[model samples]
Target chain A: MRNQHQNGTNHQVRHYQALSPAQINRFGLVELGSSGPLYRFCVRLFGILALLGIVGFMMRVASSGFSDRAAWGYYVATVVFIFVTFQAAPTVAFAIRAAKGHWRRPVSRIAELFAVVGVLNLILLLPVLFLIPPITGGRKTFWFELHWLLPFSAPGFFLFFGMLALVVCGLCLLYLSALPDFAAARDAKGGIYTGLARGWVGSQRQWKMLKSGLNLLGAFYLMTFVLVTTLFAWDVSETLVPGWKDAIYPAFHSITGLQGAIASTILALGIARKFGGLKNHLHMEQFWGLSKPLLATSLLWFYMGWSTFLTYWYGRTLAEQHVLQLLMFGPYFTVFVMSFLLKFLIPLLFLIWNRVRMSIMGPVLIALSILTGDIFEMVRLYVGPFTITEVGHEMTHVPAAHLPDFADILIIAGAISGAIFIYLVSSKIIPRISLWDMKEGMLLTRVQSFHRAEVLVIGKPE
Target chain B: MVDKSILGLFKDPDSTADAVDSLRKAGFGNHTFDILSGVPYPEGTFGEHGPGHKLFVFPLIGAICGFSVALLLTLGTQVSFPMVQGGKPLIAIPPMMVIMYEGTMLGAILFTVLGVLFESRLPRPGVGLYDTRITEGFIGLLVSCPEEKIGAAEQALRGAGAEDIKTESASGGGR
Candidate 1:
C-alpha cells in the first residue's frame, strides 16, 4: 500500500501521475478496405441475379395481372412484415453492454437515420405503381380490379406527387442533413467511398448548403412519413376483392415499416460489426442504446395491433366480418396466431427482463424470430386478399400461390441491400467514431478524486 | 572554483502544486504566475493556469445559430410551402419543435467537435521533441521565469523538488 499524507480532515493527499497530451497515440481507424473486392462482387452478383430473376417475376405478374384468379399473397406478406416491423422487432439491441445507457453515442443516431431511410421503400413503391398501369395493358390490375381500391382512382389533387414528394423529400433531407457527418467521414482516410466524400468542407459556406438541403428534406419528412403509410395501405387494399376494408391499414403499415426499419438497422449493425470489422469501436454500449428503441417500437406496435383487431371484433357487418373470420379461422389463421405469439408475446415476455437483454445473442435471436414472424404476418394479410376464390366443389385453394416467389424476395432483398451497402461501404472511407468528440473528451475532461482517486474517469455529477 | 550544480539527475515533474497556493503568503512576486500540471488537474486543485484559449464559446454560438436555423427551416420554410396537410396549420409548431431540438443538439455537438479541433490544430502532424513517458502517465512541468533570473530559477526549481532540470530549445512553434 502507498503512504498517504493526511490533512486535518479524514482525507489524505495522494500523488497521481498525470497524462501528457504528448502521450496521446494517434490511432488510425482500421480500414475495411480489404473487404471491398468481396463486397463489390456480392453487390454485382446480386444485380445480375436480380436482372435474371426479374424476367420470371415479370412473366408471372403479367400472367396473373388480369386473371380472375385472385392474388392475395402480396397483401398477406406485407401485413405480416408490417406487424413485425412495428409490433415485434422495432429496434435491435447490441450484445454485452448495459441496455439502458446506450443512447449517448453514434449507434442510435444511425438507427434514427435508418427509420428515415425506410422512407425510400415508400418512394420506390410509386414507380412500381406507375409501372402497374402500363404493365396490366391499361386494364384494372389487382388493385383497380377490386371495388375497395376505387377510391384511389377517384379525383384528388395529389394522387401522384403527394405520395412521391413525401418520401423523396424525407430521404433527401435525412441524407443531406448528414452533411456534417459526411464531412466528418471525408476527413477520415482509406476505403472505396472515402474519395467520394472528399469535397465536403465543414466550412460555413458548406453548412449553408446543408441548411438548404435539410429544410427541403424536413418539410418532406413531415408530410411523407404519414402519407407513405396511406399509399401502401391503399395499394394493398386495392389488390383485394371488391370490398375488403380495414381502417387499421395505415396504422398497421406505419408500425410494421417502423419495425422493419429498426430490425433492419439492428441486424445490419450486428452484421456490419462482424463483416465491417468495426467491433472494437462500435461497441456494445451503442448496440444497447439501439435496442431500447427496438423495444419501445415493438410495444407501440402491439398497442396498434389491438386497436386494429378490436375494431374488427366490434364491426359485425358482413364483408368486414367475413374478412375478420377468414383471418381468424381460414387459411391465414395459423400464421396470424404464430405472428401474434412470436412477434408480440415472446419479445414482450423475454425482452423486458434485464438479463436477457444484456446477452448479445439473445437480441439477435429475438430480431430473427421477429423477422420470421413479420413475414408470417405479411402472408396472413396479403394471402387472404387473394383467398377470394369462390367456394367450389372440386378445387382446394392452394395457399402457396400467394407466397412471395423467388423474384419478389430477391428484388426486395436487392432494394434493401443497395441502401445498406451505401452505409457499410461509406464507413470504411471515413472515421465512424467522432474524432472531435474523442479529442474533446481528452481536452475538456476533468477527473476528480473518486473513491480515493483510484478511478480516473470523466467528472460526473455527484 | 569548485562547485556542484544541483540539477539534472532524473526526468521527474515537480508536482509540488499544493505548495504554489501558499506562495502568496510566503511573499513571492505575486505577478500572475501559472502552475503547469502533468494531467488535466482542475484549476482550484493546484492553482494552475486555465486553458490558454476560450475555445468553448464558439460552440455555444454555433449551437444558437443551429437552433435558429432549425426553427427557420421548420417555421420559416413551412410558410413557403403553405400546403395544408390533414387540416394541420401551415406553420406547424409541434413538428417544428422536433426539428429544432434535433438540429440544436446536432449543431451544438458538431460545433463543439470543430471548436476543439480548430483550437488545437491536431491531426495535422509534424513531430517535435516530447517525453513519451509524460504520455505514459508521467507528469511534466512547463513554466517560464524572468530571463535574467534563469540561473536563480533553475536553483529554485531544484530546491522545490524538480528532477532532471533541462531547457528545451523552442522551435517550429506552428500549431
Candidate 2:
C-alpha cells in the first residue's frame, strides 16, 4: 500500500504511486472499508432512526383509516427517497457504459450498489398499496375492471411487479458485472466466495461473454428504469388528480432522478476518497466526467419544467391552470421556488464555471443543493395531487392548504433514514469499487506531461 | 506420458509479449502457451490471433424472448378481458408500449448474463498455471513443452528477459 508522506507545508498535496494491474489486485484483496468510528456511529444512528420510522409508519397506517391525505406525506417521501437514493443509480452505471467513459471504473460499482435499495423500495411500496383505495370508488387510475384481465389491471399489481422485476434485473446485472471480483475474492478467501465466483476463469471466452452480458444487461436495466419512472409519473401522480395531465412531467421526473443519481454518486465518491482510503483510485477526472451530465440534466429540468408551466399559463385551460396554481402559486409556492433555485439556478450558476466543475467540492455541494430541491419538488408534485378531492371526474377545489402532521414527519424521516441504512449495510457486502474494471483501466491508462501539469491519457483501440 | 509445463515470469508487458512471439516462431502452437497478467491487454498485443467470440447472439436471443413476453402480456390481457377503459380502446398502444419496452430490455439483459456465464464457465476451479502474483503486476507465460524441448523453451524465455521460471511435470492435463 502506498502511504501519503507529508512533505513541506501542504498537507493536502499527496503523491500516488503508479500501480500495475497486479499491484491493483493486491489493494483489492483488502475488504472495502471506510473504517471510521464516525462512519459507524452515523450508520447505526440512521439504522435506529430507520427502525423508528418503519414502526411509526405502521402505527400511522393503523391510526389513519387508509385515506390518501392520511398517507400523502409518506407517499411524497417515498417517491423522493427512491428516486434520490437508488432508482436513478442504475442510470449512472448504464450511461457510463453506453458512452464507454473510461473514468467510470472507480465509481460504477458505487452506483450499482444503490440497486440493492430497489429491494427496500419494494418493501416501502407496501404503504402505497394500503393507501390506494379500490378503483370502484370512481377513482381514476390506470387499472380497469375487466374480469378476464382483472389480475393485471390493478395499479398496485403493476407497481409491485414492475418494482420486483426491476430489483431482480438489478441483482443479475450486479452479479454478472462483478463475477471477476468475486473470483478474486474467492482466490483470496475461499469460503462463500467460491459459490459466488463460480466458473469465472477470466479466459478469452469468459471475457467476451462478460462484456456482452454487461452491455446488454446495462441497456435493459436503463430501459426498465425509465419505464418504471414513467409508470410512477403516469399512474400514480398524473392520473391520481383529475385534469392534472402534463406530458413532460414524467420526462422531467426522470431527468431529476438522473441528476440526483449523479449527485449521490459524487457524494459517495467523496466519502470513499476522504474516509474509505481510496484517494489513489478516485481522482479529479472522475468528478470532471460526471459534472458534465449533472449540468446537462439540471439544465434540461429547467427547460422541461418551464415549458410545462408556459403551456398551461398560455393555454388558460382551467384544468391545467388549476394544477399549475396548486403546484406553482398555491401553498407549496415557496417549495417550488426553492426547488427551482436549488436544483436549477444554483447548480447552473456555479457548475457553469470549468474550475468549479473540475474541483471535488464544487460538484458535491451542487449535488447537495439538487437533492434538497428534489425533496421540495416531490412535495409539490405528489402532495398536491393526493390532497385534491375529485368529484364527477372534476376537482371540487384544489386542496392547496398544507401542514405536515407528526406521523407525516415520522414516515418521511423514516423512509429517508431507511434508504441510508440499506446503502450503508450494502457497502459492507459488495466491493465499493469494481476491481476488474479498475484493473482494465489501469492497464490501458498512462500519464504524460501536458503543459505544466500531468495529464492522464486513456487509450482506445483503433 | 509425463508432460512438463514451464511457467515464466516477466517484469514488463513488452518482454512477456516478446517471449510469446519468440516461442510461437519456434513452433509452439497457439494452444501450447497461455499469457496471464493483472491487466487485460488486447489480444493482438502479443502478436497472437484474437479468439472468436460470438457473444452478441445472447442479447439478440434475449431481445426476441423479451419482445415475445411483452406481446403476450399486453395483447393477451387485452384480448382476454376486453374491458373498455374510459371509453378508450381495450388494447391501448401507448401504455402497452411501456410494458413492451420493459419486457424487451429485461429479456436482453438477463439472457446476456446467461450467455456470459455459459461462455465463461465461471465459478469453475482456478487454473493451476495461475499465480496470485500475476494480478499484482507480473506477466506470466505458461507453456507446455516436450521433455527434450524444455531446455530450448527456457533458453528462449531467458533470452527474452524472463525474471523467474518454474517447471512442473504433471500427468494428464493438455490445452
Candidate 3:
C-alpha cells in the first residue's frame, strides 16, 4: 500500500518513515527484550519440539545403531535438509551485504541470526559423520585410498572439520556484525550487553575494521560454504551411489543451497513481518527485491537438475539407468515428481508472472513451496543413495525406496523445529533488525521531489 | 606535561562536523581528535583524515603461510609414503589441491578475524571519557591535548554548538 507508481518509469516509490538514531536504537533494543504471548508460545513450542527431536535422534540411534547405514537414510536427509536450508541462510546476508544493496539493511540481521542454527546443525552432524562409510572401505572417495596414518575415517575427519570451520566462521560473522549493536545495548541496558559489547567505542578505526572484517568474513563464509557443501555431496551422497559420478553434482548441490538460502530468508522475512512485530521495517520492497533472485535460482535449480538428468537420460548405460531408477523412477518416483514440480515447474510457472513475483505474499508462498520441495529433493538425492548397499563403480541393482518410520518423521520435524528454536533464541540476544545499519541507511537516504513526484534518492558512499 | 582527553557531544551531525572544523581552526592537529558515533558515517564526513589499516596484508600473509604449510603437509605425506593408485602419481594434484584449498581458506579466515580484533583495539581495558549519549544519536569528538590546551579545546567545542563536554586527565595516549 505504501508503494506508489510513477508515470512512465517502472520504479515504484517506496515509502519509508525515517527513524532517528535514538528511535532506531530504542525500537531495536525494545524488540530484543519484548516477547509477546505469541512469541513466547512459539519459542516454547519449538523448544519442546527440539527436545523431541533429540529424543527422536536417540530413538533412531537405539533402534538403527550407527552400523545400520540404510536405516539412517531419513536421518541423513534431515541433516542435509537443515544444512541446505537453515545453515545456508547467513550467505544471504553475506551476498547482499557484499553487493552493497541498500534494501538489505533490515534483512541482513534476520538472515545472519540464522547462524545460530549452525550450532544445532553441527550437533546433528556428529551422528552423520559416523553414518558415512570410512574411505578405507574400498569405496570411491576423494581420499583415493590414502588412509595410511589416519586413525579416524578420512571423509569423516575432513567433513567434521570442514563443518566445524564453517560453523565457527558463521558465529564469528554474526558476532562481529552485531558488535556495535551490542555496544548500543551496553549503553542502554548495561548488564550482559556490556560484556558482549567488548568495549566498542565506535572510533573511526573500529568502524573501518568492522567494515573490512565483515567483507572478508563474508567472502570466507561463502567459499567455506561451497567447499563444505561439495564435500558433503560427494562423500555422503554421490560416493554411496555407484556409477553416479557426475562432476556437476556438487555444484548442483551448492546451487540447491543457494536457492534454499533465498527461500529461507524470504520465508523468515514474511514470518517476522506477520508475527514478529517487525511490520514497520519489512515491506514489499524487501520481498520484491528478493523475489528476483528467487526466480533466478528457481530457473537455475531446473537448469542444473535438467543438465544432470539429461546426461542419465541419454547415456542409457545399465549403470546410469539403475542410478536413474534408484533416484527418479524406482521406489522414489512419486517423491521425485513432487520435488521436480514444486522446486522447478511450479516456481517457473508462478514466478514468471511479474504480478506474482512483485507481491509480498506471492514470493512468500513460493518460498514455502521451494522449502517443501527442498525436503523432497534432499530425500531424493540423499536417502536413495543411502539405501544402496553396493560399493563398486557400477550399480548392479536399484534398491527399493526406504520409507520413514515414526522416528524418521519425528527427526524431520524436530530438526526443522530445532533450527527455528535456535533462531528464535538468537533473535532475543542479537537485535533482529540491524540497528547501526538502519541508522546508517537513514543517513544515506532521503526522499526528494522530482517533477511533481517524490523519488527516493540514495547516497552510495565509498 | 600530562595530556587530557576531552569529549564533546553534539546532537546534530552538522555540529559534529563543524566541531571538527573548529578544532582544526583552533590549532588542534587532525591526529589530536577522532569522531565517534553509533553509525559508521563515511570517511571524511567530518573532514578527518582517513586512517590506513593493514587488514588486507593480514589475509595475504595468512594465505602464503597456509599454502606453504599445506604444500609441505600434502607433498611431505605423498613423498614419505610414495604409493601409486590407479596409475596416478604419488602426489595426486587434484586431491592435494582440495586439501590445499581448504588450508588456504582456513588460514585466511583465521587471520582476518585476528586482524580485525587487533586493528580495532577491542576488549579495551577501560573506556575513558565516554558518554552513553553518544550511542543515543549523539556524536562524540574526542580530543587528546596537553592539560594546558584543554581550555582552548573546550572553547572550540562549545563554539561549534557541542551540547555537553567532558574532560579527563591522561598519561599521553593516542586512541
- lDDT string for model 3 (A103-160, tens) is 8999999999888888888998888877788754457766644367554466776777
How far does residue A368 in candidate 3 sit from its true spot (Å)?
Answer: 0.5
Instruction: Please provide TM-scores, in order, for all candidate models, with all chains considered together.
Output: 0.54, 0.88, 0.95
Per residue, candidate 3 scores C-alpha lDDT tens digits across B67-161 of 78878887887788775655577778898887787778878888888899989987886566788887888899999999889999999999999
lDDT of 2 by residue, A162-221 (tens): 676678778888887777777677666667776787745455556666676777777777
Ranking 2 against 3 by DockQ, winner = 3
Residue-level lDDT of model 1, residues A1-462, one tens digit each, is: 222333222211231223233322223233543456767776676556546544644654665553423442452344334323521221321111123231233343344344343443444443334222221222222111211233323112123433344334333433443433443333333243234433333322233333333333343343344454554455543333333455676676677666665665566566656665545445454455555666776788788778766886787655555656556555567778898876778778877877666655566667776676777766665555554543311122333334466655654454444444444444444334433323323444343545544333444211
In Å, residue A42's CA in model 1 sits off its true spot by 4.4
User: Chain B vs. true chain B: TM-score for each candidate?
Assistant: 0.64, 0.78, 0.91
Q: What is the lDDT of residue B170 in candidate 3?
A: 44
Interface RMSD of each: 13.2, 2.8, 1.6
Show the lowest summed lDDT stretch of 10 residues, model 3 chain A. A1-10
lDDT winner among the candidates? 3
| Candidate 3 backbone collisions, by pair | none
Per-residue lDDT tens digits of candidate 1, residues B92-174?
67545645555554465455445544543322432122232332233333334445444554555555566545444432221
Instruction: List the candidate 2 regions with Cα displacement exceeding 4 Å.
Output: A1-16, A65-72, A130-153, A391-393, A449-455, B1-11, B26-34, B125-129, B140-175
